[model samples]
Target: MAALLGPVITPEGPLTGQLAGDPFHPDTKHAAKALAQVVEALLRAVIGWLYRLALLWVMVDIVSFPHDDRPAALT
Candidate 1:
C-alpha cells in the first residue's frame, strides 16, 4: 500500500540539483529526505496493522478461553 500511496502523499521538491561526491550535496539531501518520508509512512502503516492484529488476537483469546469458576466436583 505504501508503495502505491507514497508518491501521492509525499510532497514534491527539488528532486534534481547539484551532483557531487560530497555527502552534503543538494541532490543527495533531497533524495534522502524523500526516501525517509516514504519509509516513515510505511513503518507507520505496518505498526497500525500490527496493533489491529493484536487487538483481534486478544478478543479471540478471550472468547476461546472462558473462565470456569465452578468447583472441580461440580461437573
Candidate 2:
C-alpha cells in the first residue's frame, strides 16, 4: 500500500493512500479525532439549547398564568 502510493506529504499530514498499514498509511487519526470532537461539541450545544428552551417555556407559562391565592369565599 505505502509502496504503491508512495510518500505524499500535505499540509494536513502525510498520506500513503491506505487507511492502515505497517509503515505507510494515510494519517487520518487527527482528522477523525477532530471530527469526533466537533460532533460531540455540537451535540452538547444542541442539548443545552433544548434544555434552555424548555426552561423558557416553563417560565413563560408561569408568568402568563398566575396562580390565584385567595379564600374561596373572599372572591
How does each model score on TM-score?
A: 0.62, 0.59
After superposition, the stretches of candidate 1 with alpha carbons farther than 4 Å from their true spots are 1-18, 71-75
lDDT of 1 by residue, 1-75 (tens): 634434322135423223234568665788899999999999999999999999999999999895997988996
Q: List runs of model 2 lying over 4 Å from the truth.
A: 1-7, 10-15, 19-26, 69-74
Q: What is the lDDT of residue 18 in candidate 1?
A: 33
Q: What is the C-alpha RMSD of each candidate to the true structure, in Å?
A: 10.6, 5.3
Give candidate 1's whole-model lDDT. Answer: 0.73
- Quote model 2's TM-score: 0.59
Q: Cα miss at 67, model 2 (Å)?
A: 2.0
Error of 2 at 13 (Å): 11
